[model samples]
Target: MDPEALNPVIDKAVESGIPVVMFDADAPNSKAYAFLGTNNYYAGVTAADKMAELLNEAGGEVGVVTHPNQLNHKERTEGFRETIEKEYPKMTVVDVKDGRGDQMISKEVSEELMREYPNIKGIFASEANGGVGVGKAVIDQQKKGGDIHIISFDTDKGTLDMINDGIISATMAQGTWKMGYWSLQFLFHLQHDIAGELEGETNLPRYVDTGITVVTKDNVNEYYPGE
Candidate 1:
C-alpha cells in the first residue's frame, strides 16, 4: 500500500464530494472521511503480551517481518516493538525484514532472520502470509518447541493451520465482517446524515475500532466460524 500514490486519490475523492471510508488499512494523510477497522497499534501490543507469555516472561531477542509501507502493518509493528522495549526489559527487537505480504518472500526473510538471530526467542509477523511463512521457516529449521515463539496477524486458513499444527503460537484476528458492515454504514451516514445533524453536519466518529481477537490453539476451532 503506497500512501504516496493512494493519498492523492483519496484527497481527490473527498474534493469531489465522494465520502471515502477506509477499512482495514488506511491512508492517514489523505482527507478520508473516516476509518473503520481495528486499533492496530493496540493489537500489536496484544501480540507482544502474548509473546511475552509464550517466552515464560524471560524475554529475549525478537525479530519482525512486516510490510512497513502500509499504515496498519506499520502500526502493528510499532506497537509490538514499543511494548517490547518499554514493558519487557529483557526483550529487544533486534531486526526487521520487509515481508511485503508475500508468502515466499516472507519465508525467505524469516529463514534469513533466524540465521542471523539463532537465539531469537520471539518473532512477530505482522501480516497473514508473513505469519504462515514464518511458521514454515521455523518448522523447517527445527525451532518450533517454544524456543522461538511466534505471534502472527489475521485468522486466515494458513494462519489457522499453523496454529493447529503447533507451528505458530498465536495470531490476531481482526473483525473483518464488522469492518465491512460498518464501512458501508459510515458511508451512508456521510451522505444521508442518518445519525441526525449536529451543528452543521452529521455526527459520526472519525475512527471506529472494530477490535481484534487473539486466536490460539485452545480456541482456534471455536473461533474458526466453520467446521
Candidate 2:
C-alpha cells in the first residue's frame, strides 16, 4: 500500500464528488470514505495465538510465508511478528520468505526456508497460495502430521482438506459472505441514506470488521462446500 501513489488518485475521486470506500485491503492515508473487510492485523494476532497453541506454547522458532509486495500480507506478518515478540518472548520468527502469491513460488521459498531454519517449529502462511505451498513443503520434507505446525489463511477446500489430513494445523477463515453482503448495504447507505454531519461526525462508519474464524479439522466440514 503506497500512500503516496494511492492518495492522489483517491483524492481526485473525492474532489470530483465521488466517494471511494476500500475493501479487504486499504491505504488509509488515501481519501477513501471507509474500509469494510477483515481486520487483517487482528487476524494475524489470532494466527499467532493459534500457532503458539499448536506449538504447545513452548515458544520455538517459526517462519512466515507471504507475498512481500502485498500490503495486507505485510500487515499480517507485522502483527504476527509483534505478537510473538511481545507475548511469547521465547519464540522467534526466524525468517520471512516471499512467495509472490504463487503456489510454485511459495513452495520453493518455503522449502528453502526449511533447509535454512532446520529447527523451525511453526510456519504461518499469510495467504491462500502461501498456505498451499507451505503445506506441500512440510509434506515433501517428511514433516507431516503436525510435526511442523502450520497456520494458514483462507477457507479454500484444498486447505480444509489439508487441515483434516493433518498437513496444516488450521486456517483463518475470513467472513467473505458478510463482506459481500454488507458491501451493498454500505454502498446503498452511502448512495442515498447517509444523513448530513451529526456533531461534526458523519453517519457512516470508518471501518467495519467482517471478522474471522479459525477452521480446524473439527469444523472443516462446516466450512467446506458439500457435494
Winner by lDDT: 1
Q: Quick one: how many clashes does candidate 2 have?
A: 0
Where model 1 places Cα greater than 4 Å from the true spot, the runs are 143-146, 225-227
Least lDDT summed over 10 consecutive residues: which range in candidate 1?
A: 140-149
Candidate 1 differs from the real structure by a C-alpha RMSD in angstroms, to one decimal, of 2.0
TM-score of 2: 0.91
Clashes of each: 0, 0
Q: lDDT score, residue 93, model 2?
A: 96
Error of model 1, residue 119, in angstroms? 1.0
Q: Ten residues in a row with the worst lDDT in model 2?
A: 193-202
C-alpha local distance difference test of each model:
0.86, 0.85
What value does the lDDT take at residue 21 in candidate 1?
Answer: 86
Candidate maximizing TM-score: 1
In candidate 1 the C-alpha lDDT for residue 141 amounts to 76
